[model samples]
Target: MRSSVLALLFFACASQAGVIIGGTRFVFAENKKSISVTLKNRSAQTWLISSKISSGSAWPGNDGAVRPVIPFSATPPLFALHGNSENIIRLVGSGAELAQDRETLFMLSIAAIPSGKAPPGSVQMAVRSNLKLFYRPADLPGDPARAYQALGWQRTARGLTVENNTPYFVTLFKLSINGEAIDNPGVVAPFSKRQTPWCQASSRCQLSWQSLNDYGRVMPAVVTSVYTTSQGVSSRVITSASPSR
Candidate 1:
């Protein structure tokens, strides 16, 4: 269930679009009123760009609460970009009241709507894209750099429960138990816990996880072992700070 939820969250993250976005993710800080995202038209044909802000959840539907809960707007709600040209889309936050304790996650969906006619006997294709958007409170405690180190790991009857005790988002790029890969690699929300069905009972097992960096880059993996019977969890950061190129 967790893997399926994460799979939906990661969906369309790498979807192809005629226009390329500037960054892999967007960050909205409490001190700032807004942030901008750049869109570049890479195709030879002109394209229309339409964007919408939606609630970021494991599973978001039309009925789900819209994101930010705070008032925000995307400039040029609709626009056209010529080939090789680029435009900036501004996201402005208007003093929306959100939890001041942790970072809130949102999603920016961009659709490249074709305006003109397709080439002879060719069908025009419109591409859709999704990007991670995070709203960070100024007073939020703890930095993401050290959050992974502080994550709580426990061996449970279902498999494993990884808990995020910090206020920053921790993206798990890799997860494994006893040299066997567990398919729970994804972002673990702040102050939330995730469970995996890797095992049916509490057992001594080796565990490892690689977190994602600020630029949406993968970080080094940390490997450790834990015993179910032990009263405390012992996890050590084995890898260095060097990020993969």
Candidate 2:
């Protein structure tokens, strides 16, 4: 069963017209497991999704050389979606079925919501990465194609890994957190335009908060992809003020 609950109030507006997309700027790699993205079918007709998670081109870096696309493998990253049931994971393009491209590692995030009228300024989250399809129009059971347009949102996040200034240890790391299930398959933290704060142990000890109080993900979710060449030494530590703050 699916819940009619709204995750985040974010959507993309199409004043004159434009392709709809979803995902997040932030992705938390808890122990480095997986990542996900969501989409809505907004086409007057049903559409299929195709994908290509490539190790795109590279440019100049600090050392002056080409670098990896996302600090992680662009080939077949894990993909899954939530369902009516909490933690309910569904692979892309299955049940309720949506079409997708061949050489793509489809995400498991399912298509649950299909708005008949996505206003001109429907708000969404992700603003980085290339566009990649995640859903089709047919995903919606009986929703007429009349007042609707099949929206196939493709989330392609951009990333780069820093060596942590360690000539060794690879200095590799990855970070991504799930967004509250509206689209993202990792975090479920909602967004707020207001400021909210919190702390524990002691007011000056340790705490975490979004601009609304905890740097919440629709607070602008962002992800960091990292990797170590592993061609040199291992285990590196960084605790310098070289940049001088």
Candidate 3:
């Protein structure tokens, strides 16, 4: 078994910032879908009752003023500009379509906020504007008719197993480690019956990769691709690893 050696840093670490700014989707097509901003109150205190994103993009009226949208709706939200730090306020919204192609640009904004009875200084402000891309359904097609398991890990060697949960042809089977492309060790047009992941070796240690299940269309392979200086190695895809029996 692998052991951990580094210091454990939980979410509650004292030095962690009280507020954080982020979004669900970073990339999307224009006029596609709205995005959602995640506001995390890492501080022990509850968010101020009056809190709402104070600063955000001014929506464009026919005249050209930025209108702000709060309690942003939808996921993968967009913002006007790129800002930094939890202390910086961020807003999201749709911008007037580009004069060139009529495509809208996502906008974000940031500003300082009043803490109210919490601290002498104003707290950080966070908000969302809108999604540049309108919206789109998940690309992964509804759940596969059949289910397959994928196994992956950080460091260490392991065996693989394949279970034909459904019927389909899994094509162009390949393997990779630490981002370096490698040829499949065992030569075979069709993966063996088990379809389990196989791997060993390391930039500094041996790793493993294997195909677990063939359900419908997804390649659905698992890889163990994480390592630690202290623990030696740990597999991220432990569940993908089949039982020793």
Candidate 4:
């Protein structure tokens, strides 16, 4: 006889499995030896908790055969989390060499499997949560909080081009062009550029955007004007900042 299992995957922020992760995103500073994250089990039943760290590119649905070697480790990788109880998971670095000038990204995965036995031929549900993990090296130039201010924007024939010259990753959201919302305005990696196909041929266009801070809090909205110059497209900030709603 063959058995079947049903798995439900969720990001840390949207997890409904009674297991609460303390933070949406975790930062591991190079100067620190390790960092601890709190996990609370609110259900009335026990669960088998498993945690691991993986490269940022790895997704929960990917096969394990092609998984990259993880440079960090989560202590107490496997444990029985009692109901209405809390546990701490420590993320420790393996002293592996990473980028010294820029921040490296990783993913922390937590899975909670029901410990009780289910009825015969019944489906079992397992909940897995993934959270972003950023490793910031010490003595990095510029302030991370203000890094988004340095982002460069240009209006192209196809769409908009965003440039990030800073060494910190910028997670952008709530993007709009000329009062129209743009779908899936994703993140811009450190020292990189990304283009989104959304702009039309306009002499000047208003671009509004918001970014997330290190603690996952939404930063203030910034509105800028993109002008089609004689040489090329350029941008100027009309409003540097505004209160975040």
Candidate that scores best on TM-score: 4
The models' CA-based lDDT, in order, is 0.69, 0.22, 0.31, 0.76
TM-score of each: 0.77, 0.23, 0.24, 0.79
Candidate 3 local lDDT, residue 94: 46
Candidate closer to the true structure by lDDT (higher is better), 3 or 4: 4
Sequence-dependent TM-score of model 3:
0.24
What is the lDDT ranking, best to worst? 4, 1, 3, 2
**Residue by residue across 98-159, what tens digits does model 3's lDDT show?**
22222122233322232335232322333322312211123333222122232222343453
Tens digits of per-residue lDDT, candidate 1, 34-85, equal 7998998866767788887776764211123344573567887789988889
Tell me the tens digit of each residue's lDDT in model 4 across 103-130. Answer: 8777899988878786576555667788
The residue ranges of model 4 lying beyond 4 angstroms of the native Cα positions read: 1-14, 58-69, 117-124, 200-205, 229-232, 243-245
- Consecutive 10-residue window with the lowest summed lDDT within model 1: 58-67
Residue 23, candidate 1: Cα error in Å is 0.6
Off by over 4 Å in 3: 1-16, 23-28, 48-106, 111-114, 118-245
Best by lDDT: 4
TM-score of 1: 0.77
Worst 10 residues of 2 by lDDT: 164-173
Pairs of residues at least 3 apart in sequence or in different chains that clash in candidate 4: none
Ranking by TM-score: 4, 1, 3, 2
Check candidate 1 and list the clashing pairs.
none
